[model samples]
Target: MPAICKLARQRLHWLGLSVCLLTLAPEAAHSQDMREVRRTVRYLTSRHLHGRGYTHHGDQRAAAFLARQFKSLGLVPFKSAAAYTQPFPLTVNTFPGRLAVTVDGHKLQPGQDFILAPESAGGRFTASVVYFDSLALGQEGARQQFLAQPLQAVALVLTQPDYQRIQAQPLLAQKLGEARALVILVPGKLTASLAPRQVAQPKLLVAAPAWPHAARQITLVLDACLQENYRTQNVLGYIPGTARLDSLLVVTAHYDHLGELGRHHFFPGANDNASGTSMLLQLARHLSQPSHRLRYTVVFIGFSGEEAGLLGSRYFTAHPLFPLDKVRFLLNLDLVGTGDTGATVVNGTLHPKEYQLLQQLNTGPASVGPLSARGRAANSDHFPFSEAGVPAFFLYTRGGIAAYHDVDDRAETLPLTRYNELFQLLSQFLTHLAH
Candidate 1:
């Protein structure tokens, strides 16, 4: 099957969570600089960055990298805007030091036999094991009873099906966390994530086959901490418009991704927002040119803590450098690595004028492939601005690879399919904005 067709089918199957691992056809290439996009993705996904998560100050490294990119591109901070970065603080749970788990005499491996819970409170817990059967979990009355009861002993173990059911209700953690420890039997693989909040009890996962059926107890040691005021920043740069000084256009992409799973494993996030950030940098490079400059000032932002929440953009819109009313329009990009089928626009219906303009430019023989419109969503950095009454749209490329929030979303595997075309389409639309 053709690569585009396969990606489209897979994308339809995955419902907006996918990536592009196929090769970019040379004949499809355009003048837009994909070399820089490739280079940026490669460096960001490199091991030293540790998936750009909070685990190792990789997020700070990512912020610094964006600042450097902005400085290199000759874009300057708007008058009221602070230097380059607007730093903020957050509290999060992290497992950077020691992580270990064992049931009886058998050792459990991270992301293999067992995994530590992201929200797990850091501690060492050992006690006699208690089991919760699938029948108990499947029964509504028993499940409610389990949630209400005070768990005693070292750890509580559950079958794979029970574990999945429990995971569906995040608030269930409050109950589970009251236990000394919680254990789940995973069937095959485990992909860990950064937990937004904390649970009082430590949690461990065990592989189904490695589960100690006869074991009386379990032991888990995790050097995790709920670090408060963890500092991070957003990187911003702008090109003063040649025409209207008061009016402006803002373009943005979140640069944060799921950080280190442990010491050895990290999610690369090549297609998540790194691909979108690469697009932002390329736009900065292009729009900075005097010949390509716009009628309204163009602000480019590389947002942080987007994976944690829309923290950076929310901060900026709340404490905007310039007046919020001055922003003529905002376009936020999340995943732009592949456009095998086309691109989808969030807020297309809410902001019909801009959406119509986009449709106009996205057609013709040299079109930017198919364009799909979606209703309002708080799905990306655009939401905060939209809620603040600023017209904003988040655009993400559709169809490609299926890797997301995992180690598989690598730079080498991304195709950059239809990237040049989308770049052209956006530039054309920007040129006609408010004209």
Candidate 2:
């Protein structure tokens, strides 16, 4: 019995060695491509790509580059019979030109001093300002007074508490949607998001009062475009399996982010998604190699319109090119630039066995720290797959610079703390999962 056990251990070790041998070139080539990752991130986040948004052909440029990479890696078409990219249409409100904001006759900075709301309807506005305590938004009398005056330009000076109160007032939202050129004075840095839908008015979020609230008028010299059916694409390619070719393992990452703030400053989404997309490409290159082919088919996807919502992933699931039931598992990667404290897995709790298996496989590779399991979040491209009942996990690195959806998330700053270890862990996990 002792001899048999030793023999078993010997065989398992040899098997592992064989697998590593087959994967050596692909794995090392991928690790060497961290330089490539940096290059790709820089290109995607560069000024010319315009933050990879729907405007200025930035998103399309990124799609073209990724498609070229896919072709170069010899990744075959999957789900699509015609091409590597799956085209889709979506509408987004974009501030493409003349984004100027003036308060009380003083022209303030565009990105530094204020942000135009995503739902804003574009056009120039010159109106006498009516200052209201954001606190008043909690009171019906105060809200009604502002809402009742249709032609009046309103400004709400918000403290954190005031902002909270205003959020509770549903009627205020209804009124604001109908109001034109509303000014909101917010404390701290200006953040932006893609509008879920367009509205009849534009809201300007300005930095809170600098020297008491004496501004009596507001002016916006803006040129915002509401792009309807803006054509964008999701890039996809696959490597067939030697055995279970029909069964699939999907790897995905969203390549979209908040594009440019006018023509001057682009939001470089390096950590937001460029990191993840670069990793996806690395994985693609590794799997595309014939020597490293798996027993189950693997698909690589670079999703667009993720910032607008999980539109691409949702569309893919709704109209999948392959059978959803044939899917063995789906792994969604995002914000993978840092892993000082290891990584977090969304939906890890929901699928304990697979999660446990991953952790088990992660035991030897101490470089990535430890894996953290988290509750499901709809904040990424994985949400749509989770909704469709496809077994999925969204993985993201947890530590390092806290650059999220902002301009600071540049390619030059990413440390890639444990990217190699993360890659190794996934490689091991997928091997075990496929087995």
Candidate 3:
């Protein structure tokens, strides 16, 4: 077995044993205290949250719920803002109209069989089909050769593992224009459950058609367009500092996830994000108390449009309430609910001092290790801040549960056994940073 997977499995076994012992022990009070984190995780990862994406009311509702929590925790706005919402604009494509696709005299049902590209220009075209295998590889030349043929027709592309490379190549679209060929993607056996009736934007590897003659009598009809004028907001809350207020410590987590595909499957995103957001809220509750004064102001940010590509954090850095230079450190929490064994801290190697401090705080007999550490990598909300020359770290737990980025990442399955320890470690780290 691979080393990482082996380590993960071993850790999982340890965590399972720990949970069993905790349940059997007479320390019900400790278990009950930990239930708060579990309950919050479940609530946020519930079906009602709709994956916390922009397509549904999930993002807005989550923002409101978080703002309420911030208010209850006594976190006031940093400046003149009335509330905790840091509104921003995001351009997104939405399917508000109709989509149609027809192949070889048969009309294909939307969402049931095929979906059009979001940027596709709606049109009806009768032409032959041309097959190009692996258009991103030597297929580019092969595609040119096919187009050079006397016949104009629909083009069938058999994409390989280089899906992103194919998508990036402008030659595909340019070839379609030159050959006047309609594009038909022959995706493998369409599983009813996984297939969308009408995909907002279809990007998938397709199998090559059986016969070359099958291309001669191809006809396709597609109706699709891009919507450009949509916007989303990120929620922000802060507790002002007392001494040396000019410096800042920011806590961030993305609250967005993949929205509902149709009606049935919602990527609950419990651990993908909602878990981290819950931790942020809990930490805000603890630190926002009047007694917890610090040298640097603490800003808690709940970013949106993260699944869409780190939009919220990018926007915040671009138009920061406090000068970006004044920001001393950003600690981004993500995927912390299921870390019964331990958690991994990204960018830990980049900031050895902070990493050592975290390890020291979590070094008790019952606590989980600092886990693995890696140098700076632009993977999450911490990316933008780090790019802007701010010291930042992305912290997440490792092992315990395997659920991630799927519907199974539900709140009910999260074992938040180490939450109190994690929180304590964070509190200590913040104190150390403050000094």
Candidate 4:
């Protein structure tokens, strides 16, 4: 028998799984877990979870599910934690129901035809449409005259550029907020995000082609609520090391997504984060095996409120379950569903030695290339950890579906092209960390 297999068998003999381990090759054993990974992604993105957002308590449900997973894996909760969950509060704007839109008597689909701005307020209005271009709204005098009219009688429809300009001009934006509603025509995809507060009036983003050229009237029925003190949590657990237990290696991913865009429209977020969360879970599963235990403690964190601007990770850094300084290295994974062209390591340029090690470790069919490197970014759960002086890298796959922050980012559409390759790379990297 090979030395590696013999070592693994000896370690696993205590659990009485040596025969089972020796029967399957390493690659086969790893590949078997891919089924579980896909199932996890699908379950997290399922309609019952409500896009895993704030609506219908999807995030809360997800947290509970992850806690169960941790317990089953034999990961221990921090002694100071609230039983594997670190709870926090956030205020968010949510569209729970009553989403209807019609332009010139043509009822449009929720995700296809339009999307409310994240901060849009609830309102019902049927009024005349007044279209405005950049040139028409350029002069301050024209905006003043427009705001002077009976705002309730009109829903101002502005070109995308004009809408952006008005938003930048706070005085004009506040004045325009008094109108029945602001309809902005987007020439491309309609992306959505989370918001902490609601605006004075509803802002509707209509696909340019969906809007009739000579539309006379518009009707909007939206129900929005500014949910204050919304309770959410960061799910975390850890495996103690056999040797350097005081030092740590952390893996993190955010499980919260854009959630539902009303009653019917939901962002599945398969790639944006479900993929990363799956990787975190998979890594935890691998490390928890008796034969795979490492020298440094491995901490796994499935953060919430990432869509709300990394609130969960920020809170953890501020009120950490373990000493922040003890974290030897941290890897933050996000948007890793595809790898046709390769992947990029954010903050790689900042840590050249570690980047070189990662590049060196990835080889054969498992290599993600052209493995690129990037500088610092505040784009993922890694930002807070890096800010807290933890050596960190945010890794994400590249060259696949462009669906992001939309209703189309479903599990069915996610390619997961190089999931196995990425998983191998992570496992190898973790092993190297022990030395």
TM-score of each predicted structure versus truth:
0.82, 0.86, 0.71, 0.92
Model 4 bad stretches (over 4 Å): 1-31, 139-144
Residue-level lDDT tens digits of model 1 in 52-135 = 878777887777777766765678975654568888886667766677677776776665566666787767767778777555
Global CA lDDT computed for model 1:
0.76
Candidate 2 per-residue lDDT over residues 174-284, each given as its tens digit: 655554566666776667788756667776777675413577777777777888999888999888887999999999999888887776777888888888888887777
- Pick by TM-score: 1 or 4, better one: 4
Model 1 Cα shift for residue 198 (angstroms): 2.3
Query: What is the RMSD of candidate 2?
Result: 10.6
Candidates arranged by lDDT, highest first: 4, 2, 1, 3
Clashes of 3: 9
Q: Which candidate number would show the highest TM-score if scored against the true structure?
A: 4
Q: Model 3: per-residue lDDT, tens digit, 219-298?
A: 54444333343356788877878887888899998887765533444567777788888778767765665566677788
lDDT values of the candidates?
0.76, 0.77, 0.64, 0.85
Off by over 4 Å in 1: 1-32, 79-82, 102-116, 125-129, 137-151, 159-175, 185-193, 204-219, 364-366
- Candidate 1 collision pairs: 19-401, 20-401, 53-259
